[model samples]
Target: MDLTRTKALPIRHGKPKVLKMLLALALLLPAGFGIPAQTSYAAGISKPFPQQVDYPGMIKPSHVTQNAMNKSVSDYYDYWKATYLKHDLSSLPGGYYVKGDITGDPEGFKALGSSEGQGYGMIITVLMAGHDPNAQNIYNGLFKTARAYKSSGNPHLMGWVVADSPKAQGHFGSATDGDLDIAYSLILAHQQWGSDGAVNYLDEARTMINDGIKVSYVTTNNRLNLGDWDAKDALNTRPSDWMLSHFRAFYEVTGDAGWIQVIDNLYSVYDQFTAAYSPTTGLVSDFVVGNPPKPAPEWYLDEFKETNQYYYNASRFPLRVVMDYAFYGDPRGKAAADKITGWIKTKANGSPANIKNGYNLKGTAIGDYATAVFVAPFISAGTADSANQAWINAGWDWMKNKREDYFSDTYNLLNLLFITGNWWVPEGQAEQPIINLALNKPAVSSSIEGSGFEADKAFDGNLMSRWASNEGSDPEWIYVDLGSVQSISGVTLKWEAAYAKQYKIQVSTDSSGTPVQWTDVNSTTDGNGGVDEIDFSPHNARYVRMLGSERGTPYGYSLYEFEVYGTSSP
Candidate 1:
């Protein structure tokens, strides 16, 4: 999650890449036009081209400027290259590799589950195969691990063991998120890289997913169980949704019709499970299970039987996992993605004005809220451009108005960057100019002015500032003045302590004058009570402001440091 700005490499957009391949047919004599036509680079390749290439030609191009629009895809690929390439698997236990981000302590981090490390490893590996060199390395490492973990008579490659053993943190079971994640990752890498080694991992991941279907999925009800019904009866929707993403990736890599069938079946299961969402208040149930998939019990926590205040922190948990799966182009997958995005909009509209501080679900705005909203537009833009635009505006508005008190950790800043880069408009659109943040400083402070506050009162103005929540509360506001009107490309905000809730940012021709227009930007509430960030491209404005709205404590007007990020239109 560590984010550092780096120069971008120049590569043609996706359209040009496909065009370069297709136009290989028509050789131009250039008899009509005075200028010579550029030669096609993909003349020799066979029909039915690959969707994306890691490096069509070797040696990164010169003059490619690195910015939010181009860097999103590049940076994701770079993470795998830098981390996994340098770390060798021979020294690691069982030849299994985590490639970093594994704390190894199961109880310390909430996101860390039984197979979390291996699961994350799998996803990373699959995503890596989208590029080159890195794909080869990932394929090799995964195969080595598979061979070591292979059991007798296990031709289908069904099981993967937990990274944390009984001696380490008390093992949960043989298979968990880690197995699914790794298995899926390996399959994707195999398909993309086409390395013989990848077959073992892909076969194993496919086997494990199907087995989970047989043992854990409730056929009559069409819901996914936590693991086994005897030990854990709870049917957590997040993991099931994540599995759908794995299936979608498998389909994209293999182009196998059967994989699509698997994805469709999973979506059918998801359709029945997602019925748990309450109509009265858009909050999804914390736990949902039933043969008929009945509503929550009366004492459960809401009018529907679940609690009204389900943990606010993991609100994006279900949506993000589901959307990642849907991004690969499944109809039902897209539905799941839409469901989560729609739910988030409702939460933003109905959220309590005053939130408690610190990292509790109800305490502060977690970073994922912004991400859930932000990703909606990106996922839908190719298919539903208008709906995507609306989602982008709403997501950016929510983040701009209230981000200070919600983010308490720096790790999530990377997520913010993803949101910004994904929706970025190519330069030269009439839009609000985003104030490029000074990366060297990392943080700046501000406080809201109260009725009795003096000019020099250290931002001690409003008592109800949104940035003053307790989980990581420390307030301040600071911003940048974009020299001119430019399409905003991206943004990232950091906090010294407590995360922010919501804020009001104004853009004007005059930095010190009244805002000509205002846009609402809200940050995601951190589920783990840490620093969070939001990102987007708003093609209008010159000045931006972060106005804190809620604090964890009764103390009013919590304010804190602010950040502005974007690229110039020219």
Candidate 2:
């Protein structure tokens, strides 16, 4: 059966009774008789939602309150969960699946969900543990459903689609994207809760990664094939499947260096395609083919006409690429991300609403309307540089509350998690800790945006809250008192969209001296917005201030968190 053409079979009227009888008989059997007992590992949740992790080099939209950001995710998940999550099939009781949208189905197949959607559901539920009380249960049900639809080509992989009719066998082939995410989510589950329970998540992840993915999906050239069935066609590859961060995680868990080769190979392919076809925009086609890797021709796989353009599949490129830079700090990833975001910022005239759905390699908009599927990835890409801070902020505002179709909504939630700093690295792969000396310290500013955004908010160690100076102002400043003169080595400024283009880190030993002598310990004329980490020679000062000379944006300087690092003076 054609993967795309296959649809869910209609349910028969009398089948419910038969299914109920079957379920009743199965329940009466021994412990290991039928489907394994579904375990709810609620106690295993370690890192829950609202993690607000301070990713080392990534930036977030600083204008909105953190509560608002968290609400956006929670509200959307509630809607998405209610609408798409389904468990009606009695054959797979306690097994859930995401229901695919069927608005324009001519044949009325009553579509069940795809393996891709199943993968997405698993990842979303695991990440949203704290916010949703039934997250673990939902996640386990999704996992059971995925396992039931095992791929014919590879037993370790799930089939591409699920059908409703008991007689109809679903498409027992695997899509690479589904397998990749499913395996990654298992690792996250292990980290979130441990492998000691009924489900050994880590062990399952290892089997999937080593036996399922490495054996079937990964080509000999270290490039990812589109699916398990597409392994014979080694040259044809999907740009969105170049998930570098996932590959890194796979390597981390399996201790396989081959995944590293996969990462390097795909990065080279990305470089080759961009340099040859899209040097200016850094946009990739949905499908890329050949040794040098050119965009696949129209009707290449009979998927769609826009395979050669940056359509639905390639729309995910930015989110995938930017995560590598955000998590691992890969310069190549940053360089690739900058090319796409910098062009989009100019193309959209700094408005996220103006972003189109599809684009040609040369940066021309192919699709006229704006949708979250296209816009959300750009928001993720915006985090790659501080220069795109305003663009990132605008993108978040545009995408936050909008409800679209399943594909759009799911991608939007995933991107929102990354944008709001809720997405975290797995347990063992986390970055080193940084101590902020100025956290919760006494602070004062030259001006404030309003009553709530006061001077002290900048020192509260919260990413959601910020302190803003008066609009369109010059010579604004925010200072933190260390209580007494203390040795300080550096400061990190998590700036809002309204950042300082020119600023100085000035320190004074005496907080209430007659002359109020202040010396510039560090200064910069070229300050870009994101997270600025400035280090200077260790100096003992009771007061430290960021003196802004010129604003980066039209508004005044603002900071989410103005962090100081050092030890107390002797």
Candidate 3:
């Protein structure tokens, strides 16, 4: 199958007479990106308009597309909290987190505590700040839980596992991946909410990066050690432990040049591994000897029934490496991504069904299930190349009806967060797309009454408050003053038990005041209660409102929070 990749070439946007071709070129370029140049509004005078890309290519995610992606992120987080969060605050301490599957059975319930998940929990918590109002609390709990499992080997590092008194292993060695993300999430949390809060995110992030993660790096080979205890094993490294982008973050936080060496050596060793074991496919082995650069036969022999293949740990390679190419556009990273993605594209024949979950070094399919965890990374890889557009679309189509098991469900959510453009970067970084925030905005309603069920309660940043009508009323509306006319992107509504079965989201400027003339932007007939995030065509509006024509419950028209999201003009 021949793939089509339209290279994004730069052209100046100017007078249409001669530059119509250029403007057309710009539109076809990629992701609805326009070329910025001096528009001659006056004599020899010009102003700058920066071009921003909305989606993966010429296409922008429609309201339905955006809504699905956003909901997937939100819903998955909710599931993570509901399914994985085991602590009953009544019995356990306020900040202590409980990890593992929540089950009532004896054996399963006993295994429902661990230090490993706190890293993942912290990441999911901080990332969902705007959507999850209790993000900080969640992070605080996760941090406390992780701190409780501090390894005796390294006081800063967390123990690999924790369980009920009977199942506790009395182990105190840090796992590399857990600490890596735990530290990384701290950086994100610092940038997201800052160090001043109860967590002191920045200071904590530095300690974890400088003292904990940095200690795991071996000076002998300029690579990551599997754990603090793996000092003797020169080349014993897990490919998944080499978080390419996280090392860059380590450098940023510590200002250490050593981290750069590790980044350089990581690719150098990766190139060596691909050249030796899986040259054609560029498939990374789960375990490898990075310094001398070969598969770790001992680990392969002991751990795997089938050795040195892309299985559980190595499967993360595409998502990790693709991130470097996607964010920084590093050439080596791109070449590595192309190698893996190109191979998958060739084998699958443009159908996601043909792809398997696990593979051998020579590209043999070891596991046949088309699991979401494995497919998600390849879909992310496709976003890096316009050539892989067909499969990217197919991958997304596949995810629409994708099965959701325990592992697949969580990874699928993280993957959705990544591939759908909801994965946030560190704050103040350039090239961040304009986001929609609705916290603390003023909300007014036509039928709202009483302080307990007031209209403004829906915009107070608390998800618990419900704005309810005085009576079971139809055609009741809740509108928010966005303060300025901004580019409206999407709307997220947290509805109470009393929801509107049919509702329309409307927006208008109304240069003059009193009552505003509203234009319907988006409408829904099948409104599911709990939470509904909707997308609309990008339009400018200062006042955004939701009009409910039909009530689902006889009690009233009610909503916990009505959020209007938009981006500022460039």
What Cα-based lDDT does every candidate model obtain? Answer: 0.34, 0.77, 0.63
Q: Pick by TM-score: which candidate is best?
A: 2
Which candidate do you rate higher for TM-score, 1 or 3?
Answer: 3
Compared with the true structure, what per-residue lDDT tens digits does model 3 show for residues 350-400? 787787877888788877667776787777777776777777778877764
Better of 2 and 3 by TM-score: 2
All candidates' TM-scores? 0.42, 0.67, 0.61
What is the TM-score ranking, best to worst? 2, 3, 1
Model 3 stretches astray by more than 4 angstroms: 1-64, 89-92, 95-98, 101-110, 165-170, 298-301, 400-403, 427-570
Off by over 4 Å in 1: 1-68, 76-96, 99-114, 130-132, 142-176, 198-202, 209-222, 228-242, 248-277, 280-283, 294-336, 346-385, 390-570
1-570, model 1: which lDDT tens digit per residue? 000000110000010111100100111111221212223323221111112211111111122322432343445435434543333433344344443332212333232112333444444444433334344455455555543443222322312332323222222223333444555655544444433443554455445545443344323223344333222344333332335555444433332223333344344434554454433322333334454343334323221221222332223234334333223323344454455545444445533221211112222333233332223222222122234444444433333223221111111222223233221111111123334342223222253233422222212211111233222333434444555555553443333223345544444455544344556544443222222345554645555555454443334332222334556553
Winning model by lDDT? 2
Counted clashes in each candidate structure: 80, 1, 2
lDDT of 2 by residue, 364-481 (tens): 9888788888899998998988888889889988888878777888888899888887777764332234456677888888888787789998887444357988888899999998
Error of 1 at 54 (Å): 16
Flag the better candidate by TM-score, 1 or 2: 2
